[model samples]
Target: MYLMSKGLWGAIAGDETTSEAKEQQAHAAIVLNLSDSQLMHVIDSATAREAWGRLARFHHSHDMANRLWLKEKFASFKYAASSMSGHVMELEDLVMKMKRANCGPSEEDVCAVLLRSLPASFESLVQAFRMSVASFSFSDLVSKLIAEEVRQNEAARVEDATALYAGKRKGKQYPKKQQVRRAKGPSGTCYNCGKVGHYARDCRSGRGPREQQHDQSNVAFHASEGFASDSWVMDSGASAHMCKDRDAFEEYEEVHHARSISSAKSNVKLNVIGHGTVKLRVWTGHAWIDARLENTLHVQDLSKNLFSLTAAAARGMTVEITRNECVVKRGGTPVATGRKQGFLLYLNADYGTECHMAEDDTELWHRRLGHVSYGTLNATVKDGRIKGATMKTNVACDVCATSKQVRKSFKTSEEDAETRESSRSDVVVCSDVLGPITPASKSGFSYAVTFILMKSRYVTVYPLRKKSDVASAFERFYQDVKTTSGTKIKVLRSDNGGEYRNETMNSFCKAKFIKQEFTVPYNPEQNGMAERMNRTLVEMTRCMLKESGLDKSYWCEALMTAADIRNILPNASNKNSSPHEMVFKKVPRIDHMRVFGAQCYAHVAKEKRKKLDDSGVRCFFLGYEKDQKAYRLLNADDGSIVISRSVTFAEHSVTKASKSRDTQVFDVIEEDESVEASLTDDEDIPAPVTEEELRTPPLRAQNSSHHGPSV
Candidate 1:
């Protein structure tokens, strides 16, 4: 351009004498820009064109070696500078150099290289741009990347100025989440300014003058804008509150501490940057209200905000957690509520408008009520007999289905039905023996017999040491019934087992004028009432043992408890009243009924214990004592039964104290016919029927002849 302005183009055309002068001027102009190395190559040139060609050949050779070197440098270019604009300028300079060497990459290749060279933080943005429909332009790509880099640096600076508090403050109410410690040394990066050597609290460039007064606690705080979510998860394991949105903070202040916090769902470290009170629109059951979260750390790295139960409790908020929900209250007024989702509990933002607090979950109520049937549960709720208890229909319970599963019942007899109408004159009773249960009872009794009064459906259990003891047990039962009620024994219906059909039982029955009606050989359905009772007691005991986490050895205690419970429960035959009410001629009081195997503390009288001894003994509630108002309690320390009237029960706390030696799964008890009975009865045990089956009208509908005893 300088030669052309000086009218030197005529020098290459050999125009005139004056053109030679122009050539000289043009050559000088070209030479002034070249170095000594380049000037050496072009010194012998006679014209400006020759000198320019020689200089170009010397520096920008188009040979394989020159092209290969330039191509390699361009392909291997990496961004290393702290300034994004400077890095792009360096890349552009390299591209121009490559073009001069005639080996520059295509525009697409350049764009790919630029994106591929960026840090992982820009991966999402790079992917987004790659997926867009817009045309690829190197200049536009560079401009956007530089703009993104500026945004990241600005955000980092702003967050760094905000004080970060990390690590959890130990609290009494809940266990703290594990803090993953970062390795400390010269390699440790300062969390504040992304520098080395000093920690974020000591970094001079972190928060201007505020870094000097950073908190010393080993807490961390970082909130990543890319990962933050709107919903807050309730974390019982967390000891401190955390949030990702800085705008959510009602009051903010800077602090300095560093530690790693992770969610139960993920192990990614959430950086803590600042602490403040975060106000949230919380659904407090009845209304949507602003709940202030005090000392909430701003953690941009967190995917979702965290509401810590431990932190809430420390602030004097009462947190009541059931299986399905967590209710948080201050001064008995609900301030926040969390619904169970998967394994996490999430605070519902629209709970006031959408959430329905109808009833405790039916499954939970099922467990709480000792796995009772939906009918019993509905009745319990409808009668308002149990406070705070409710039932929802159609909710299936796995435990109930598994533990209460029974074989289909046999066809009932036509003339001698299993259930029939009964009166005081009919004084009929059904009897059955259950056991040689494994891991024999605590009292060493391996067998038990139950007597069901035909009319009232009142059940009574007698623990027996052996099969032969059934006869003696029956005599005792008969004597008690005869003395208590002047109703003489009329009909004793039972399976044709040696325990009931033996000579001793026959002689006693003959003397008492009690006709022994045995079921046809192997046809236990004829005596289905007794057969069904055995299965019902066993199933109930199995559920109670499993639910209470008690040992199988306590099956006998559970059996007795089940029988007592069965007596008070409404019978299918007598729709209006329970067996206890029909038999005792008074409404049965269930208010004193506690869960069968609940933890309790029985009071020790001064006379029973020394002055230095503890006044209360930790025990498990067994059942009510038959003769008195006292309760049967098993001493947790000694395994001995304690009868006490003064007992404090904890029904809600079902502990898993089952011993490893005890089988976890309860197998249905199959009658052990192979074992020598010491005597055999000429009868085949029928498949057992569950209590629900007997009560269900479809299977055991009342016969047209008469209604027999309720199973």
Candidate 2:
């Protein structure tokens, strides 16, 4: 890559033409990717490659002191049986880093080190490696090791599946032929059968009708449970913007111990740390729109950041959610939008990160929380509790005012009551289409569909190119769920979309002996199961995107990740069990879960990368790969997504902050090992400026040398 006009490259190019402007942009990007120390010396380099070489030299020299330190760690490392590949990957990355510094071992030397790192269980492989020619390179050894690792992982997964299904089968009831009933007796009374004498009193039957059926009603409307991570939840149930990050406030006024939130059938006492203005960053149609949220309640130790619909409605703003983004409109004009992440909706990229806070007043309580009845206020005052102010409200699930009595939105009666019993998995399923997400996903999908099982509230999502693909998606999903659960789907419910009402879908369902139920043409509530599922997946997908610091183009992957996490979480209707447990009959192992967007190193086999290239490639964690016991990671270098069981994650507690794009700064959130590589931004790196340049006169012309550093 020889540079043309090399002298003018590193220093900013002339604004002579559009091509020159692009070259200047490229030059700036190359510089911005440098770290603070590297930026100091490379600032005067005459070409991008020159600056890069200088940076490499600088980092190499600095990395020297720790060379022996890394060597010792490599020798002493022992691969853990639980995650041997991950351990080996970390060691390999360390070796690569040391090699870049010109202070690393030779191929044979590294091969010996890798063998030593193996556990006793790999002693057979160790012997095999030892007996081979000593000329064998580290890359070849790594390939063999990785092959063994993948095989072992597949065997373990198969064992787990076998054990789970076998145990499940031993307990599940399968239908058998019914016995013939004896002649009817007086009033059809029978001792064995509870029915009016359809059978004789002494009638022999394997089962008795009088025995009460297993009561599954107890699983309904259950209480709350803890989440694996404290991601924000955009809840229809929450009354106001409830936040845990005190740094997000523009103003604050702490109230003494207040416990206003009630969920999961238990009361959590999160004292109102303060109330103030918080700015949330949203995507408005195309660009970012920073929206200032007022009257947000900051609570200490809160599990999630909640954005209330009631608050948005109060401010004359409307929130409309879609598959790719959440749109907030004012009088039908879309003003703000936020991409979805796992189970949360957010605008600012760093929504939960710590930010600054100022002080405020207690009067904002009555000023904000909602529709306070004076009678209830008096009761609260006498009871030594806080009371909110009265306001015209539409919040049926307001968080702040739940302690007080509220007016009911609707009365429960015959018409509104749910009559069907969804007591078995896949007995009743609902599905709906979500989008035409403008720029399609990596899979070239512009639309998506959601299928929810009514009994367990378990969701399965499929990305689609168009609504027409609905039949194919359903056929695939039907086979997967049926094979996994060993149960046939009884019925499917959806809106009257042509995709669902068409002959293809109708004929397929009819052939399977499955019923198809349709909600009225314009009534979405009638198909609420799938409607709510669509919302949940979108909300959760936005949270994952916001958390990962990735763009919206990855929404399909984010949605899949969101859906997976959601299934493992407790169902709102049944707090005691998660959808995964209900459907799969086993608790999911969530202990191995890492943050969605954490920095990691994925082991690259010799077959994948060049021999001299790094043994591991830098990646950002996307989510777990479906149907495979591996992680789904995006190659940060090329934007290609890959799945691998051999990967190492660098975990750290990242600080969250909210800022407008113009002033936003990247917080190098990673363990020291990966910080340098993670700091490089592909765009928007500010050029280094000196005090001399700052002091120069603005009127200086193109020839003034005093202006400094200009090409």
Candidate 3:
């Protein structure tokens, strides 16, 4: 066997150690004998020195070669270990520094250095090392190294386990805990007998010792000879003694036939505990009864089943009784009193009669009182006051009729016509131009024109520079009126003038299919609507300008303001409905109207004002608030037109005109110069003198003089 083992050992050592001494040593260590081929195979397949060392460690012992090799490798291994240990300590110090700096090592830095140097199987090596040094301090650098190595090994193991598990087919299995029922013992001992063997339900002591002291025996007592069920039984919860059986009740009725006790004819159904509901006829009356069951009847024990006596039964009693401690005195005496108990009674009395009771008496009082309809209450009072009087019938409230009368209807012809008229979208309109007064104080415009609508009497006025620009003025008028009225012009009427006869006016009329209605030369009456509007606007403007003590230059603003007011005011021709209302189908809301040229105050928005500045500026109220956003004002100090939301008006100060009249005078001179310049430029373009013009200058009596010489 020794020889065979030596041969096996020799084979396991491999061909690299072919020396005789080595072979002999290898052979000595082996045990079992083997054939040459088997020996050779063992030698060829022998493990490396590191593997042998690992095997030695796994077995908790070192073989001869492993011990010798370990001794030799110890120095190099210790060096590597010391170097790695130093690196670990440095890494820990760096980590502390990083923590102090509130930062950690970058993932790339960790991966490239620490992870790259670690062995492929380093995780397993680390786990084995950690198991060997399990009691080491985790705060030490060596422990951290081991822990990191173990974590890597665990991650590798998890990956392998996950892959293995994922590759397997799923199985159906119930959880172990759910497959069985756990057993438990009972909770408490019986209190009645002080025994743990049985529950309270099986105990024979009836009740605990403390509860038996107050028990009372049931007893029967006779109420009266004529009362139903003469032997009255005492129940702890029972109110006054009651018997509801039909035969027994009939017997009581016969006995009390002469006592004036009337039984109710109602087939009233009442709930009886344990017996369900039973139909009963109730009898109620005042009577004296003897009490014999006092020991069983405790005064404090009142059942929820009996509360107040029913209304019918209460009324039937000589004096009605209730569950609450109440006594209804009609002529000043006690009627009834008792604590609530099982079975309330309904007394028999006049069907509609009411027993006065306080609202706080019982739930029944609240319920019955709540249902007592005011309409049915036959009591007389003034203004909800109640006296001790009965009413035969209800009275009608005349005050209600006077207070709730319907409003009178207001019907008008104008409203009817407005409802019947075609919408603004379906109308054709007409208008004409009218004025040129002094230049406006604001725009330097000297003219104002009237635009009149023929279909609806809607008129608008515009200020202009010159009547010579009449075509442009007409275009402006058409655009403004059409935009406001949402209607197109079908006909236009005007007098013949070089301005009106121009190609611009003719082309516009042709394009729009507007029939140009003209008056006879020098006649203005044909365009009566335009003419009348113009006259009215001019007069209103003149009056306003004169009253304001301003130059005629303000005629434009005055004309516009007057036109707006006139269009909104009720006219006699339109049946007191304004032209604006007739055209727009509704009265324009004029609640925001202010006096023209009146001083007014306007609010300033935070965004538009400085923090320290006042809220509004002083200005004149030129017209109504327009377009719902801004007020148009003439800045009296600058003669400048401004639209703003920040202004304060001193209505009385409107008389003060700005010191800017020089601007208006300059504007007039400039306009005259422009007209003269245009005329001069036309003259500069020379034309040849006509022959008829030269011959006409030489006209003489030459023919008559020649005839006299021949004779």
The lDDT leader among the candidates is 1
Q: Per-residue lDDT tens digits of candidate 2, residues 1-711?
A: 122333444333333443655566556656544433345777887755556677667656435568778777767765432233334445656676777766777767777877887754457788987887666655456546644543333322211011100111112232222322232334556534555634432445534443333211000011112221233444333346665654355455665533233322222223454677776655567676556767777654454465554356546776665544566679998776555442234443233222111213122222211112223223323332232223222334222232222232233235433443333346777787777665567667777777777777777766777789889878876776677776588889887888899999999999889899897655665664565455445544554455455666676666666665556555435456657677778755433345566677786765667856776687877776654456888888898887865565543333121121211111111112111110111111111000111112111111100110000
Better of 1 and 2 by TM-score: 1
lDDT, candidate 3, 533-599, per-residue tens = 5434543444444434455555555555565555544443453454667666665432233345555
lDDT of 1 by residue, 1-711 (tens): 445566776665456665556778877667554433355677778878888777666667677887888778777877553334435545666676688877878989888888877665577788998899989687668656644643443333221221112322322212122322222333667654676776554545634432333222221211222111456767543456777655356577755656445432213344566788875677888897767788888765455676766566657777776656779999999999987543345786631211111244345445544566666656655655444456666567665676766444434344444234432232787788877777776768777777777776676677667889878877876875676565567888887788887899989999989888887775555555666666666667777787777887777667766765666556445556766666566655454566777888787866777867886798988776654556888899988889876566655456554554233434435453322211112211111211210112101111111110100
* Ordering by lDDT: 1, 2, 3
Candidate ranking under TM-score, highest first, comes to: 1, 2, 3
Worst 10 residues of 3 by lDDT: 702-711
Candidate 1 residue runs with Cα over 4 Å from true position = 1-369, 410-419, 422-426, 608-613, 661-711
What CA RMSD would you report for each candidate?
34.9, 34.7, 46.0
Which regions of candidate 3 fall more than 4 Å away from where they truly are? 1-432, 476-486, 606-609, 625-628, 645-711
Worst 10 residues of 2 by lDDT: 702-711
lDDT of 1 at 90: 56
